[model samples]
Target: MKRSKPRLAVFKFASCDGCQLTLLDCEDELLAVAGQVDIAYFPEASRAMAPGPYDLALVEGSITTPHDAERILQVRRRARVLVTIGACATAGGIQALRNFADVAEYARAVYPRPEYLETLAWSTPVSSHVPVDLELRGCPIDKGQLLEVISAYLAGRRPNLRRTSVCTECKARGTTCLLVAGGVPCLGPVTQAGCGALCPSYDRGCYGCFGPAESPNPPALAGRLAELGRGPDEVERLFRTFNAWAEAFRGGGRPA
Candidate 1:
């Protein structure tokens, strides 16, 4: 008997939906992938629905409300393989910036009726509530990497993702060492490789959009930033951008 096609679902909580768009942006590859699996419940792509238990689920957002915290558990129960895509789903994205501040005060300033808002004090990753099989990091994950992950899962193999720092990308692209050559306060030495060293090629520093690399030495990078005239506060702000809550990047530049 022929094996049944796997069911794939895409979920969202609190995000800009850039990651999901990355999936759609895989125009040619997506058509081929679609033939291999059943695109069961991707609201961004189609109105057609398929109920769980799903073979694979791609979640793309942070848990910013109590409802989402509870909802993620339900999604976990339904998915055989759960993968979190993007910084929001893996490290809470830029929204995690609120984790360090007074959320209630910020709410009051933004909303006309803060009391009516039903948000949590902190925005956290999907993994905070459920067990995730994999995490693809980026503000919006790279389309090629996204394809590799999907195909890898279907093939029962690990995705060929690099865990090196963005500095490696610079070296691969023959881009100049912005920090050493220009004295730029770059996070490339600590930030994960994925964006292909896009910023540094244009003479700007890496902003840690893909979060901290595997075993990243953020403290050492912070010291280098200090040498480039960056103070503790400036260094802290740099690490707390797209992947603020990632442990490797956390508390690195705080005063002693």
Candidate 2:
């Protein structure tokens, strides 16, 4: 008898859909992945939907509405392993800036009739709504690392996701430190390793798209920024970018 292929499902909530696109962007490896697993559901890739008690579910996006709150519970029930992909699902993404501001005012600014829109006051990460098996952090996750995660799940092994800072990648590539050499404000000291230091290689500081590194010393980094003549507000603004809702980036006080 032949063994059944593992069923895979991909889900989305409130997001830009960039992370889901990363899987599709994996043009070379996607066909190979399809052969290894049953692509039972992936709305971004196909309209053909499959009901699930899925072996794995890759969720991309944050929860930003009452309907999504209820819907995610159902997803959790149907999925054996729920892995949140991208900053939106893992750290609440840029939309989470609403959490610090007045949602009512925001709605009025964006829409002519705010009453017609149904939304929560704040955007929150997937873990806030359901128990997550894993979280893959990034603005748009690295395709190579994403493939490794899928491969690891299929083999029943832990995905070797790095918890280091982007500074490590910068050093490995022999890229000059933007902060030290060019006097650019960089989150590379605290941002997670991914993107292969793309911004720094192009002579720009890292923008913390991968979220905070493990136990990042953001305060020390803030002090360094001050030495570089960045004001307190500028330092706060830097931390409040892609992963503003992440605990490490948010710090002890309220998010800026």
Candidate 3:
């Protein structure tokens, strides 16, 4: 038997707390959403963690520790619907650069008491360890989109997230094509829409903060970047930024 208002929980593992902050930042909408559901276990907002068989779980962060790997399974069991929000939860985030290197060696170099640390070799997405119902991609995530997702949840419908590229967003905003006009080696063509085509509009290349667009052809974009005087190494570095461990971005902008 379900309650009149569904209970929602927010969980975190290895993250910068950006996405959760985005939820809190939805100031006005948060109040509205609060009326629709019970925010039962959001540690960032409240300390009271009601024992859950949560109706909806909004998870932020990657699984970077052994405990988190186990915890995600617990979360899955408790959550009827699990949505991974942000790059960390969906594509492993910026810290996933460690995936390409020796984590032990890096830990030893960075920490004076490296032996005290207990962590996984790779900072991995939540879905790698447990089944996820939906993914909201971003470093921090957009408040409007977050509200849309929550609204969809309350209404018992699929959240209509756009799968278009940042290039498409640029067109919608009437922002000039920096790739064509400024010859910038933008990742807009292959990157997912969101961030409002932020970087490109500000005279910088899109860094793919939202990861790959639907069926992204990264190699094709790499070729274009190469033509724009970017070397193979440079293009590889570009793909390794925010969503480094994402499957589409993992091959260093190779064909996905």
Where does candidate 2 stray beyond 4 Å?
Answer: 252-256
Q: Could you give me the TM-score of model 2 versus the true structure? A: 0.96
lDDT of each: 0.91, 0.92, 0.91
TM-score of each: 0.96, 0.96, 0.97
What TM-score, to 2 decimals, does candidate 3 have? 0.97
Mind giving the per-residue lDDT tens digits that candidate 2 earns over 1-256?
Answer: 9789999999999999999999999999999999999999999889879999999999999999999999999999999999999999999999999887999999999999999999999899999999999999898999998999999998899999888999999999999999998889999998899789989999999989899898688888888888889888888898888899888888621232
Error of 2 at 73 (Å): 0.5
At residue 192, candidate 2 shows an lDDT of 92
Preferred candidate (lDDT higher): 2 or 3? 2
Candidate 1 local lDDT, 1-256, one digit each (tens): 9799999999999999999999999998988989999999999999998799999999999999999999999999999999999999999889988988999999999999999999999999998899999999998999989999988988999999999999999999999999999988888988889889989999999998898888788877788788778888888898888888887876755432
Using lDDT, give the best candidate's number.
2
Cα lDDT over the full model 3 = 0.91
